[model samples]
Target chain A: MTEAILKVEKLKKYYPIYGGVLHKTIGYVKAVDGVSFEVNQGETLALVGESGCGKSTTGRSILRLIEPTEGRIIFEGEDLVSLNDEQMRKRRRDLQIIFQDPFASLNPRHTVQRILEEPLIVHGIGDKNERKRKVVELLETVGLNKEQIKRYPHQFSGGQRQRIGIARALSVNPKLIVADEPVSALDVSIQSQVLNLMEDLQEKFGLTYIFISHDLSVVRHIASRVGVMYLGSLVELADKTELYDQPLHPYTQALLSAVPVPDPDFKRERIILSGDVPSPSNPPAGCKFHTRCRYKMDVCTKEVPDLVDVGNGHYIACHLHR
Target chain B: MDLDKAGENVEEDYVLEVDQLKTIFRTEDGDIPAVSGVSFSLKAGETLGIVGESGSGKSVTSLSIMGLIPKPQGRLSGSIRYKGKEIINLSEGEMREIRGNEISMIFQEPMTSLNPVFTIGNQMVEAVLLHMELSKKEAEQRAIEMLRQVGIPRAEEIMKEYPHQLSGGMRQRVMIAMAMSCNPSILIADEPTTALDVTIQAQILDLMRNLKKDFNTSILLITHDLGVVAEMCDRVIVMYAGKIVEESDVRTLFKNPNHPYTKGLIKSTPRLTSEKQRLYSIPGNVPSFKEMPKGCKFVPRCEYAKDICYKNEPELVYVGEDHKSSCWLNIEQAPSIEEDAS
Candidate 1:
């Protein structure tokens, strides 16, 4: 039940929308519109919503780092949107990422051993003292201390510069990372020590993540299949305890009853969803979350639903239990 | 709730007290302190909260209770008092006549805390003509009635619009209608919806619980969201690397959290109705006050430390009935709750 290792499919990215001073186009902002999922292998998926819901442009269009205009990411079985940027720069060394501002994603004049030895010197790997012992063993496996690898990223601390951006996305050993809001600019007691050092470096490197967040309680603590995203499509995916115990999308039960649960007599029934989100360059024409659906129907503003599954593996999209 | 039988008319039962305050900063690599001995009080439409994270001094104790710090480079000290008076060494013309009329903060980037070339009706009529005696057409009719009591919708065309013409939840409801246009009996706010959007942080926590039930006000609030302090505090405190490692009543600090850094910030957050598979996280790094350790600052990230919690400094005590905590393991939590209920 676990082979996938990234699939994606209907994808789409869009942008276009020009118009002001003779610059014509004027249309698309769809931003990852027909999104699809898969992930599997070592698990962790996530991708959540809200904030123009493209879920960080579907985690930078599965490492094409934004340039999707349409379908198929595939990975490990090719198709990273049909490669070629000289074979997607050798498939960007098994694609890595981890951004969300560890004080503006590091490099305040680089130092943590030249930012973990510039990704093992751009994946050339060993040549200078075995790239300074793999940049001091990726700064002691992201807990840092190879004598603070000559310090710099403004002398470390937004949880040691997100453990030097998770030791520069595990210096090229990355078999898929894409972490985006990696602990949303940290400090909730260092976001659980960088989500338990990204779940102990994905159980010591069998990796495959894609996390991208909007903090659904840090995606119910490091996902393992979640998805959701809205304006730019893919309405739901499942298992993280069946989408936090039975969500089946109404925007995942108003984003898991709009999060906020640090208990104080944990009450429930929230589902607020009133106004805002709309314009992904003029979105609404169909169930683009039927304008913040509280189960809206009447073919939710002229059709579009389609995600489907509804069984043990949960998938969703809408038309109230399709 | 009884912060030691106060006397000297501390404003007839606390409307903001503070006491052991502190602050510090004047650094040439020296006195950084940053709100060390912070005390509490609030009461009258209560709320309280604080919590911590990020050099835990909860925005320098709400900028030393809004005398907005920045003095001879931050150096504040004990008492703050407010209605009971002291106002931490007043005079910057008696603290700009108790700034925004007896306290009113609201920060966490309402886009650089507003003022992109004025016009939210000239900054809510220059804070209501610098603390009320009104007049530029009666402070533009009390800034269009605080931009229509903060729900802002054509409230006189959002007083000629500007803070980059709205939306980040309408510039945090025009910074909560310019900090409740001088309704200040203590508002402060700080991480006011940490740059929003969880459906506009549940519509700015339901517009700050309906402006604290229509301005009975007493807020304070600072953040680091323990779910916005269990949806708008009642009594909290917590902080860390700069003291008060726990104080209670937000349902007994979310049901019995007695400081091992408030049970590692309520078992390192991530809840949305619990599932866990490893995430308790409080292991090390937060000492900083140029490496302060040798005795509790969560003793090098605690796992219930032992040797007198690394040689001394515990004292917060009181457990339950206004549940305090500082922790030398709450003096063995009544023999570890009778050995975990036999």
Candidate 2:
């Protein structure tokens, strides 16, 4: 069995909502509430859900980009949560992130070379000449020509800009990459190109990926294991084949069914949830998805179901499953 | 689906017919042809989908039909017939009569399209009051009724709420409510669900389908998602570099896609059942206007490009019954199902 590269236990990130004249803390928006997962080495673990499911927040928290309110993020036997800012900064050399929007993420003023070299420079990896050569190598690794290195972010297409972003993330030779909706902003053709590129890069570098995306099809393509998050908690987690084929959780089933199949003749049993996802700030008790779940039970409203592995690593959190 | 067979009674047959429509924008760089000589017809109650990437000119075609293109900078040519009457060059005042009353449009970004300051009722009533003749109180009731029809909960309360008060799904439902309030025969929805999440997108698509059935409204859906097209559209037009590469029924387009670009698009989209293999991707990017190839616009990316493909472009020709593909291979001989480039 593959060894775990990162293990997150009861991870939580809550933003306090202020109210009253003195702006006292009224309530907490539980963005990521008690989420737990283990990402194995050289495997892609995809976290998928609708928007505001705290998938992005979880990815950020794991990287220490957003400080976790309470959790133990065990990375290489060391708790990342306990690390000081300076210590965390040093650890960043082995951890990287690729953002959703290539247009917004990349600095428009800086050339591709400068953007790629920035991480290397920050990590104090190599000297000027060596850094320059490394930048060219990184650009080539991400499928960009060396001549285009002098061009600004605006000069490249959406696909090429994402390549530059990947190149930047790879400059420091990170082991784990948290790519947050890496291909969502791209066109269909370009999206495939980038997805393929990412897959190729993963194999070449033997890297682990925490792919956070709302798109199910893209996740199905890239992920070895899949975790379906709802409200602020993981409702289901399993192997990609098991998750897609037989989703135990109601939210997972609904999410998979909601994805429109491309073939016109492909008839699918769609579980169209009645209303929008409930507000995360004041989410429903017990199962947060109880408001939208079709098979809502009495136990669902009063007691939160624990994410317990049914068998073969297929973990489900639902009253029905219990 | 055949325009010639529809005969002289074009108004009674097809709701909207766009013939050789061309829209070009005069930019600082040069004049870029956004939508060049694109032609298609929409029958009443029929959903025609235009699928393409970002700069593929799908949105431009819809804007041209709406007469929403800004003059001086953006020039529009060719003919846009609404119920057999040429309405392409109608004056702003003349076009206003047909804009919302006869044909209405819903944009991708509901937030940007909807005015934030005004309440939902204010916006809905304004659209109804503009093209429709009704009292303010009557329009308010109509707006609430429309909101209720689109599946918005607490319709009365929602009418009082601003655009910001609602979720992304709710905002989109409101947008549909506003678009349908006038009960336009032809509803032009440009990526209405693109900004939405998968679940919300499903909701919106379901709403659109229901609304179409209820109103028997002809829809012009402009989107890049083939999945959305398969779910919603009857006929699909595959656009690339401001030209229609293929046109067929949704089923045929998916089953037996004729154009190389069309095949590439379908294969490239990561499917739920797709094996964990390297996704087949088109070799190169869409050519810019300044650097468009002399022969085929897709020649730069086409693996099967021959000598002829680099010299002269192919016209949209019939490959099968109710199907058309613009490719040299289609003209040369029946295209063999070649394996995708590795």
Candidate 3:
């Protein structure tokens, strides 16, 4: 049996909403509420939902980029939440994150070589000469030329900048990489090239990925397992094929149906939800999706459905599936 | 509804006709040809989708048509015929009358498009009063009606609020309302939904479709997402390296894409039905404007490039009744319609 590399148990992150002249904490925005999932060794787990559904916050919390207000994160048998600041800094070498906008994440003043070498320097990987060589090697591994090392971030196109970002993420030789909407900003033709390069790098380095994106078609392409998040909670988690073919949660089904298929012959019955996603600071009571769900029952509005196992490693949080 | 009537008259009644429109930017280095010799016509009430990767001149073409391209640095050439008059050489005052009154545009980023200092009501009222010759009170009422028409709940309250107070989706709806306030003959949307969420994207697309029906407006929708083009457009124009590489009706373009670039684009996108282990990506990158190829721009990256393709540029040729492609490949030599399925 395969071993789980990262285990998150009921992780929660809530941002305080300050009000009044004294800036008192009035309420909390429950960004990530009681979310739990596991990523197997060298596997890709995709977290998908709408923009404010807390997918990005969940990814940030798992890496402790943002401190979780509650719950445990067990990585390689160590509770990351229990680590001190200095110890967590040291452990950061084993975990890294790649941001969505490559141009924003990378420093405009720094050269490509400097950007890639900073991670190695931070983790105390090698000396000057070794770091230089490692930077060139990393650039080559991400399908970039060695001569591009001297160029600034603005000199490269969006895709090349993203490749530089990927090289920077892999410089530490991290065990788990959280890529947050990495290729969504890129063009269609460039997107596939970057995705293929990512798959190749994953195989070469045995990297575990937590891919967070709103694009379901892209998630379907890369993820071995998929988790659907809605309004700060995991609605459904299952294998890629099972989730795409037989989605248990109504929200997941609606999301899948909403994606416009490429072919004209294949007609998709678009599930147009009437209203916008409710504010995360004041989510609806009970099931968060009950307000827009077509199959809402009386129990759905009154009771929160637990994430229950529904045969063959699938988990769903819906009263109908229960 | 009169499908035959609509189909037969589409070729004759074009609200806007752009012929060989070229826009070049005079950078410090040299003249960077952003848009080159692109031609297309938009019939009344038809949605034309202009699709391409970055730097493919899709947005540039739309901006040139709307006379929104910045001056001094950029130079516009060729004919942009709107209502049987060439708009490319129109003076600033004349173009100002055309802009927002006859032709309006919605940009990709709503936050930047909207003025931060003013309330939504103030902006909409100003727009309506500027073009419609309405009184301030009448304009305010019209602005409220526009807001309600765009599906913003509690129109009066929303109109009183500032742009920052609204969500991204609401802001986009406000933008649509402002653009539609004048009831322009042509609407140019340049990646309007690219910054929006998927569900919001669908809602906005549906709203635009409904508005097109109600207002009978011609739309020029520019985007890189093929999924949107497939769902929203009656016809599509595929651009590559500052040129229109292919143009066809939506069904024919998806069914039988002619140009190598178009084929590469469709193949690279990961669809819901695609079951391949890995996606088919186009090789290499889009050429920079300064270093464009001498012959066909797509030859360096095309899989079906031949010796003739690199030596000379190919003219846009008629491949079907309403389909055209700029490629050296002989479309007539290919198999029948049934065998050319994508």
TM-scores for all candidates: the values are 0.36, 0.97, 0.96
True-structure RMSD for candidate 3:
2.2
- Which of the predicted structures, 1 or 3, would earn the higher TM-score when compared with the native? 3
Report, for candidate 3, the interface RMSD: 1.1
Q: What is the C-alpha lDDT of each candidate?
A: 0.80, 0.91, 0.90
Predictions in order: chain A TM-score? 0.39, 0.99, 0.98
Candidate 2 C-alpha lDDT tens digits along A187-209:
99999999999999999999899
Model 3 CAPRI quality: medium
Count steric clashes of candidate 3.
Answer: 0
lDDT string for model 3 (A261-298, tens) is: 77656776788787889999999999999999999999
Candidate 1 vs candidate 2: the TM-score winner is 2
Ranking by lDDT: 2, 3, 1
Docking class of 2: high
Residue A25 displacement (Å), model 2: 0.6
Docking class of 1: acceptable
The sequence of per-residue lDDT tens digits that candidate 1 reaches over residues A28-91 is 8887788877888888888788787888888887888778888898887888887678788767
Model 3 clash pairs are none
Retained true contacts (fraction), each candidate:
0.65, 0.82, 0.59
